[model samples]
Target: MSHLSNHDLPRLKKNLAGRQEHNSLKRYIERTREREYIAAKLSTHSPIEVDTSYRVAVRKTLINPRDGLSMKRIIGESDLLPVSYMQAGMKASKSVCRIEIRDSVGRVLGHGTGFLIAPCLLLTNHHILECEEAAQFSLAQFSYEVDLNLMPLQIKSFRFVPEHLFITDAKLDFTVVALENDSAEGTTLSEFGFLPLYPESGKALLGESISIIQHPSGAPKVVAVREKKIIDVYDDFINYTSGILPGASGSPVFNDEWVTIALHHTGVPDPDDSSKYIVNEGVRISSIMKYLNRLKPTLLEEQQVLLDSIFAGSELANYDRNPMVIGNLDMEWYERSAGYDAIFLGENYAVPLPTLRPDLRRDVAKLTNGKTVLDYTHFSIVMSKSRRLAYYTAVNIDGGHLVSVPRARKWYYDSRLNRKYQCGPELYNNNDIDRGHLVRRRDPVWGSLAKKANEDTFHFTNCSPQHKNFNQMIWLDLENYILSNTETYNLKVTVFTGPVFREDDVLYRGVKIPAEFWKIAIMVKRDGNLSVTAYLQTQKNLIRDLDFAFGSYKTYQVAVSNIEILTGLDFGDLRNYDPFRTITAVTGDIEPAIVNVINIPSDIRI
Candidate 1:
């Protein structure tokens, strides 16, 4: 055999590296072990056997010892209860212990039955921890079964692992609780024997038999195993024939060899036929092992605090007190997306109203007169118009209702004059650029007298100066963003944009005015509240004069006051107009707290 050179050796190593599935294989082995453990534990309990001959004889003879014996036998020989029965028995025996959870209060918020996995370790769901107040769990008030009813089980302590110390993949829905000590006195299964866990192999064969033992509805632990086959594999769910029920979640499913193949989580029920049960679903054990490996280091660090709390027997409470919005409107609102639109493409056209021109041009003034603009981007047509103020009645009629605007047209001066008199002869020249209305012309309601009245609304006279890039890029982004917000918050927005005017000879602060400047202003309203935002762009980098060029101090004040008068809502304090700050506050409210818990520094892989 020829020895390979260094160059060839590197290539060979890279090829081999790509084929390594060691981690996946290792997780498979761990799951198999858990399954085996459960199967072994269940096999130890014998199922009750029925005496068919005695039953037949009893039916024929009314008063015979055989008949009596048959009845007694039937009553005594019940279905076999497996190892799961013992666990369920433990839960039922202690059900009344009142698993108290407090959101920094003594009042009970949420309650559930808990079991001692280890001396100090307790188990519960992840959602139970959400609250504004500090939470604690306790078992001190719980009672064990004595006679027919439950009696108090002395709990030494209650401690919960910090949210960050553990990893929970919704895919698995199984949370592991690491205990401080392994010494808790309870009914020992050691006498009957424990279930064996499955070995770490790929998984059970597609048609292999399986069984599950769990405490259903917190009832007595029952060993209900079914012979079923693996039907399908989903991203995070495994479909099998094993039967599962509520309170059975987090139970282990074992193969014939007693290795754990998966953790039972839920079952799908047939809606058409209630009697027909569907496949049971579970989180693959291999996935669980992957997360466990990731979480192990963090768990080790917090092992002491967790154990101490369990020893103290603290009460656990849930505090999800946020108001749930319940109504038709609440259902309509949704999170904003990048591609939301305001109107359906096939809808009838409606004219938009003109508003105040930022350029102070009288020709374009009518577009700003508090009329509605149709948003065309979203599927539903959103009309953005303010309620009109009634002058004589003193009562505001039709004040805040959405209204349609009529479209119109006008003309602009050609660009020839600019070339003929270039420099000092003419201060300004009207170019041939079409006076395009940003609000649009064909959008207004048709067949009404207002139809012709809106014709001028489409003219360039009602337009603003906008560069191709600025209009198509930044302006488009802004319009799309606002429309998305309308769908998300169910609000309406009116926009006004146009070019700024400049004089050829006019000089302010030793600088000549540039003709290619543009400005945009937006007004939004929802639920009687109104807000206005504005921006400006120019051919020259206008960052230095952005504040003044968009609108002077006096211009902004007048525009805002005018908008307030037209919309009938206070703009609030200008100091509170920080868009970034408002967005940050809203973002904080919606983000899940679990992210913070899981991102703790200690949980970071080294």
Candidate 2:
């Protein structure tokens, strides 16, 4: 090495006298636009436009020059604590665990980390045990931390009890699990103290140090000190600056006081350089706690007591325990089967809501504009919030004199159901798909309520995504044939129509286009027969590589019992009255009757 001369020393002193600086608006705008562009791409919305105000915000003190960080407005600057204090506190708590997700052969397919939140409960990322097979056979090893001399210690392994109470949400990305009170080695779970969840919502602040105790790559557990800084905090997640490896997933991120702040989940690579990770991500602990509190009532008494103890001395402990249903829809009448008065069975019976599957989140609310329940007459509809489609529509059909109401081309967005909540004209714009009415326009037209019921069927909530050919040809043909069947005589017919919402549905233009539709028609025949027939139609062939062009759709007559199994809705006694039930029993082979396209009306079993 060569010694520095007098010239070199003077130059270095002059260079160190001032700090590095740059003032380029173009550079600033370019960086800001790049970040916003990435955010818009990640989101479902359209690309964001960087306006003048956004540029000013960028030029102002929005980003720190030293570390290129922007603090959350809600988080106070005083929330950060010293690194030494945080590490000591977390070491004393000793709550983190090593998780191994195994396959059927007892071999580990993946590895993750976890932490105890309650006496017999562990909180981790949902991806660790997303599937039933992995969740059922996963192993959780506690006390895997390094000893005083930095050597491996005796670890206690615990098997997961997924069947008991495994609550997980894909959007939130969390899995709350209840561990056995005793481990495989017969060690009490209470021996390992759990890191208490930070009760307050904004407990973790941006730019503050975060501590993590994890088993990186499923190696022996070790403590990582304040090497991470929280970058941003949202309603459900906390983005941070840290280098978390694959096995570090589900690791507990703690504050200075050892209060669990977040559960580590993901990482973001540097945009300019993909090889280096820029930030890590975690599911906020506060959101997880709220979900756990909501699911507390369904837990065992022992689990409840454990949760109570962990949540003690916090405001969340005394929070309301009421489980509120969405949209305040009364499910009592909807859940009941053949929900109608027995006395009015022959006259003018109104069909009630079908028993919607509880697993599907259907936020059914009364559509109210300027009318009461009476104005709706013999028709009722329930809408699914997530699917943006009708769960089902129930209508009473009078086969006496079919009302000659002209088809109203006037399609209005049902203001009764919030405009944002319904699948409006945006989905059908420039497409061959029609707003197919579940309660056919003329189905509910009867008696003195003919005019009002006909108008109510025009509501958007009663509509579903249907191809023009499927709706006009097969669907309408089936409806007209059933009503004109001579067996109807003067009897009233009730029909329940709905879309089959499968998880793997084709998503198009922010809407999930259903592949199949189901309709169950019930009526008292002329021969005093209480006949029930269920029909299914598929529009999968109509959609070729997302090009939803008009094409032929096949309609099949399936058993009413099969509808309950496929839709997970309880049809109750309706299955007993199916005309195909006897035919299926006689043959000792359960199969759906395919409708013949050539002879549509005669093929239907009455």
Candidate 3:
């Protein structure tokens, strides 16, 4: 087939014939005038002059004598003087403006800078407003230099990007502020002047040249054009060889065409090496633009609402003012009852508190082996400072004596073998499961008047029903682990133990029985480290009714491993109790029995 058909050629020729000729003379005049304007502006002094002290400091700190002499020599020898041209360009673009923060005092805090964005929106780091309790900011008129002399410049107002609407990806270290009220007074843009946004998809390639315009260290606007290679692009930030300095954060970076592609943010300055220059890093503009486009609608709506409210007198007139009240509860309350005090102090203290007493408190404490009351119930009452809060069982002289057996049914039920065994006894089977104690109630010290004063610790609110085998094996192991570690770790071990009530009315032989099987949950703390372990009995009877309770064993094991890694303490030995027994009871129920012997070393520190 022919590349160009006869019909296509005629159409192409007809289209070419309709093309209009350009006015070469007018175009040439326009191009010449643009060049003249750029050159004249470059030759002129900056509209905002640099402070003399800053100039002197820069010369003393940044300018190397050898390099300065060499640059002078190079300027004399070379036909191209780009540095001089850049200096001239910097001077022409500089414009001084005043920044003011409206505070609760109804007065303004003033700062100076060479600001370029119009309608006079001040660009600043987000952290600047972090401490301010105000809702708005304002700007005032300042001065600009013209013809080498300072002239008054009017500033209508200031606008800030919405704090809530803006999105920031710290990985990129970039933020975008969309202009809201562009109608601010004295705001103007040159016909050819506009901040450029990055094109989507492609990035500035390696070895690309870039320029930055910023008010470094609150100095006048300085345009630094440098040719630098892109060294790295991380998830959220880009690193380049372009020079940047302190106080340049939020400054714009543009390409040779004056198109802004990035916002200057941070740099590493090397004071040890005089010849070393700071490397600049910035947030890519394309990322910023994407976020801004998403936020534009919301920001516009919010700004309109704010404006309407301001004009309609609906806005809070003294919204910028700070409140004047702060107080704390009396320490006496905490000293009297640590448990009650902790609940109040933790969070949302204003809300009504839940009563420490639960229904289980009355039932479980009444079912104890002996007629004596549990210690934590008394502790709870003492902490609450309320006699009504304490629950006690009627003293029964006929109740069985508190038997402290070395190996209990709880130990066998808590064993790994019992947990692995799927077939188990029924939960309420009298012959299979046995009730076990975590904090043994009959132990002399635990039952003593002083120890029992902290009733909250002994209350049945902390107990759970578990299988006899699981409690004896796994539960005993956990308790032993805490006791073993406490010798040198100074750990405080608080345990809550009880049996699950199968029925409120199950009769054992002739007597009414509460439940079978026991459970134990222990909270241990040493120095500042805290850990919690829970054990459920896996007796043949109990497992049949509640297999799901031990389903979290895998997760618990993982947590235990993590604790071991962090604390460098071994708790695995605690799980080494014999599992063949039916009922293993804790033996020694005296004051200085197993409890007192397991005292943690007081010298252990965090």
Candidate 4:
């Protein structure tokens, strides 16, 4: 045989490259046809959302595990009708894409394939985005496929939403990151028909024929189907014979119905021949979901909504948070007609309201009147419209009715109140002020009414801006300690809280920052006598010298009567039951004792 001369080397290499490209294009076309066939068959029998036949097949596979079948057998036996399958493939193709991962300075570091699990979320391999650094500089290229004319490629690129969520798990080798809601081209990710993550596992089978839509070797998008089969299934991993190359790391593995089953990760190499591969492996979608469920409750409202879509069949579907409307829950009511007054048993079966609401400000501030009275399951509030803050929030907690629900920090603007008059996220964002819930989240959470009350506290009308240090430390401890030892109050306690809106309060960003806040906790004692203790916490140090950063706050147990005088809001008959009433001086003001970390619980006069 004659070896090629130097002159022929260039031609030979060019011919080989052209051949490889041709083979890739051929494989992509063939798989695209298969994907469409499956989708079309699916559309004929059921609505897209509820594919009963697909579910039944998955269920059957799980009930009786089977060995892998030959590619010929799998394809020859496919029952997908061509027309419907073509429609389905066309629908699903929009979701699968070739992703180019770039580093800082816009240089492409690597490439992979990712699919949308939610409108704003893309699921990929952890190895593709290992850390915040990787996420900070990466770009997600979607629709990187040949145009209808089959000459030029069509693609949309999106940067990661820097201020959004980027969660990764190396142990599971999966990363779920949020894409910018819209690309620079103004195309929303939702318009792409993003694939929803299958919450449950009855959707994929042991011997199912799977297809991988991927950007193999960082090349243009391709669908690898002909040789794919789920050879083995482990608890955390699945082995398949899908055709993939180096850059197919995060490609989605889907069943005939276009439902995602697993995330393609790595391929096994043939030990005898290093150049060839044996079987490819992927992280099980079910396993990825288990990890996602652990994070749902803790995510922000928008994030929870995204996660809820993935695991919609589970409890997350009814997630009541709406990002557009600040603090709006789907349930229709400020009061659920569930009668929260019933919990205020004994002498006062009714929640105490402020006798006199905060006087309208006579200052240079704009008066957009948001002062709206709203009622929740376990609490009520009289929000000060002019000040854009709550005048007072009254809450009745049946200490005996405790629900160990973790606090859901889902803040919102009360819909009943005008958004302009409400101090919203703008005031709290990038500032030292914490959006303090005047009606503590856990206060109203009891029995069946817990969820509503927990949700109620998120409204901006029921929230006030307090120093972060003050809200999280002694202030929070006081609430928690009181609830923990509820037996002291016969398992029932009522709290009245609000900011001390003095005219001279520090002004920050057009909103008056209250320097002080007060809380009065009332309960029926063992003797059936009403007992009330008042406490005041101040973040005066934050703005005293124009040093408006968060600093330590002082807590003092004062007379309830003093709180009434200082805030100009009456605390009802609770003033007469104050434990510190006798401690008042000749000036009619009870001197406050310094409450420190050492005696936060004991220092309280209660």
Candidate 5:
């Protein structure tokens, strides 16, 4: 159903046409038939953003091939599809369901369609399941269709578990939610196989035939297969012709292989006459997968495990992470990516790496080529030879161009450094210690080199041996908020990070576990001035017999000078730019406390 009345339909179209994203979408759709444009797009996102396997699959299909063949000629290629196409469709339909939206008293409000993207997770339109509260009050009813005898099958219904996982994006107009594992009718969610959502764009192309499994107007499930063709495929959205029924919102749009392509949202109305629809719009599944990767780090351990299951056997698995070793053995590390640009924020606002104190410089590890600084993708590391950890790491982040790199399980050792000083997997064996990243995996992941940077972060030179609890507890909350805030504000930032070492640190498994870590962020403010801020996270040190915040570490917004004094390093002129400079201090009181503890987003200072 339309959100706006008939009278306002023309005005809605006019306003939408003015949006930058909408304009870009139209331009991309218009140029889809151009061979040069298609080739350019493929080269830009292929292998990483657009997987190689998906490309080969799309090539074998009758869809819009990149060979410049006319749509008329390609239609004859449909015979290439498998003979079990009908059986594939039958298996896919089991995941579809009718989402019954209701009021506080359990009165039926309306209905929409949804599908299982995971064993116990459902995907639908945001307009249907708007918020966490809305999802909690709704029900997902499966097997509502009739049997072969023309009698209704016993319906199995499940309630939403929003507390476990509820992620929505208003711009994309999609919602991904968790459902109870078991339904009221004693049916396990595993009985219905899910449509795994992949993050590559080669699943479909412009002019490809698409299908939608919908429960129109609260009725039984129906399949509108290959009726409405995909007219356009662009950033995060797919545009199709207007053959779809009005009440089919929240349906899952699929390709010939029954693989999901989009989440059906709304129809585009003809501006001149509101009664007639022109094109239909849906949020791309690939875009949603990318969004999930960004939010994965913030999820609980259980939630992450569930999410990882979706991509278990696919190309994103652990073996595929070291792409060169498995997929392209001939390929070596590409060192062309400019690492840690000092003036990335502002041309004149240069923030270089911290200079080491005289005594600390003697312990700096040099590579085989005699360079003290090791460059990898967007970040650089300066390792401590004696401590076998980074003295400090620097990274340049382009928040605007940032892309989510699929997570990897293995942390590798840099070939440039010897195994003895690399602090590889030996320290973490049979222990709760984590290979804490100094240059965060996601920090340097942006632009075309996002995948490379992600792999580079796994190198041992970029991490420190830290406790598992400290790596994922209160400290994680504080860092996520601060970094997200900076990305929201400036869109570009340079960060410096490392652990605060002590002479008498706890020696666990032949390595000293630094109980505290520090980070400093620099960004160009909207007013064109440089803004720098420093943070400190303290954790329980067994050897020191220190504990705070019920043994959980506390993150604080400390002055840069204090960090300099503690780490025995020089931040150059960057120290004077601290916003919280004079408000806090390193005191001598018994059980000394940091005055500016940053527990939440609002507490962080720019």
Candidate 6:
């Protein structure tokens, strides 16, 4: 706490005490019956609240309504709310994140709190992120807190793209900066929904309880709830009691309904003694909204739309961040072929879907049939509940029976499983992320159920976030060669595909993006013996300056044992049938077989 005085607080207080906006707030708080004051107060109330005999908003203000209108929904009127009220606070907290102020050299300068006011935009203190250059160097980190198990959850960091859009008000102390649309790890910024800045007042009143979601003193996220009371709301600021005071600036102050009413800036210092502190003050949300409206013309049309959307889209603010794709799908439209026939290659061969480790069982989403495998057409998917994606997908590919279904490319949520456990379009929107299918859509489109299988492949559970135009293209090309080469002999092959989940995979839009993807192909060869091979999509070669390099995505034919180790799953007897394993045994070692997978597994007569 003492370190903050030298770093953040002293400067923050100096800005507040020295600025004209700060004194103007105090003057507004002092005067009650001025025309400007009345007009400002009226802006907080709607003309629509049924101005009955008991409560006439404008009329009473005309008849001295300051105290009357402010008390409409005040504590005594109706303080009790449903349990969902607490849940809303939890939802609202998603938008709030810890801001690590860093320099050009990546040195962390200080920490503050900030929240999204729009999908791409973040709101923090001008003192914290003073300018576009400052914003560009700083990073916004989310999920920097403990999980249900009390273990520290993975923290995801996103760089600011303030050059895209940056607006700051020094006097009132707020900065709205844009973030990169997608995180380095494929998560979209839109997943943490924004807190809309309301222009009108009456969201909270003097004496009403308020809460502040913040990163106190640069620690993990915490909420200072209830007991803290709002003392007064002025023209541009709200002064409030400071129990569990917001040590970190830029914290969002919320009303009972979880609506953001102000941006916490600094404490009101005691004049007689600098060591003593009085109530804390926050710049009002309405004031910031008004400031934005004044500067709205300066923004580009699309930026204006993003700004305008915050107000128009407040209804969606209460949902868990990025409830992007959600709807009921008629199970009847689905293709119900028995998923991934293990013996599809015939009586002599078997490739049962890979088995998950005992520890991973809890993270697997079970279907209505009480099975971990979600059977659809020629494929079966085992989805991860935590990652909201497929742990692995096994599909029986009938190379000869492959049907050409026109690609309409629409994705859906699997209603048989809970929506909360599924990643949706929200993860892919506004980014170069491709909704990659674990089971290649064409591979499972076979026989009478071909079209339905194509449609079934569109389910979100079958999708994994992939780098668009880069690894995805190369990976798809390599897969096509394997399927086409298999058609030359067996006319049948079974494939198992999945992500290689790493503890440090990039977190994008509430989901961790897998760095590498893998696939294993099994089929009967022309020699009447079974064959197995593995391939992996790695970003190591395609990485340029810490970002993906387009056209450089490399696919390598690797040992089946490599795939098994990468993914925490066991492929039964498949290893004995692996050409790479045989090669490894004879040579005492093996390397990734090929840069491009055209070096077909020796089992296939390419």
On TM-score, the leading prediction is: 5
TM-score of 3: 0.29
Query: Model 3, 1-606: lDDT tens per residue?
Result: 224332443343233212200121222233455434533542452211211343222222221232334223221232233354454344324422333444444454333232333221233333222222322343322332223454433333444444523333433443222233332653432211223233242234333345676656544445576555444343334456745655555566654334445666555333456344345566665565455444434543333222211111101111101111122223232243322121121132111211223433333222123322322221221111111112211111101111111111111221111122111223233332232333333221222232322222222222222333342322333443333333322222333333323333243323223222222222223332334342323243334433323322110211222222222223342222212112222421111211111112111111
Candidate 4 clashes: the total is 9
- Top-lDDT candidate index: 5
Model 4 alpha-carbon drift over 4 Å, by segment: 1-331, 335-343, 348-351, 357-372, 406-410, 483-490, 545-547, 585-598
Candidate 2, residue 206: lDDT = 46
- Candidate 6 lDDT score relative to the true structure: 0.68
Worst 10 residues of 5 by lDDT: 321-330
Assess each prediction's global lDDT (C-alpha) against the native: 0.32, 0.59, 0.32, 0.62, 0.68, 0.68
Compute the lDDT of residue 371 as modeled in candidate 2: 24
Q: What is the per-residue lDDT of model 5 for residues 1-606, given as tens digits with 9 covering 90 to 100?
A: 224333443343334323423443454456557634544554454322332465544434323222233233224244244446667687888999999976545766678899988656888876677677777778999988887797898889999998878888767767889898778877777677677666656666655677888898889888886787665566777778787877777888987656787888777666567666678888888788888778876776456544544443122111111111212111257346467788777668878888999999999998776888888899888888888989899998765556656554456777666667778667755455556767766677788878888888878788787654452433433434344444333457788889888876877667777877888888766676677888888765423432212355577778888888788889998877788655555542212344477654347777
Candidate 6 or 1, higher TM-score: 6
For each candidate, give its TM-score against the true structure: 0.28, 0.40, 0.29, 0.44, 0.52, 0.45
Give one digit per residue, the lDDT tens place, for model 6 in 426-448: 78765656677787766788789
Deviation in Å, model 4, residue 601 alpha carbon:
0.7
Task: Flag the better candidate by TM-score, 1 or 2.
Answer: 2
Candidate 2 ranges beyond 4 A from true positions:
1-344, 347-352, 361-375, 549-551, 582-599
Measured with C-alpha atoms, the lDDT of residue 452 in candidate 2 is 54
* Candidate 6: segments with Cα more than 4 A from true spot: 1-73, 77-80, 315-606
Candidate 6 matches the true fold with a TM-score of 0.45
Candidate 2: tens digits of C-alpha lDDT, residues 16-55:
2111101111223335555455445434421112223332
Looking at model 6, which ten-residue stretch has the lowest summed lDDT?
Answer: 58-67
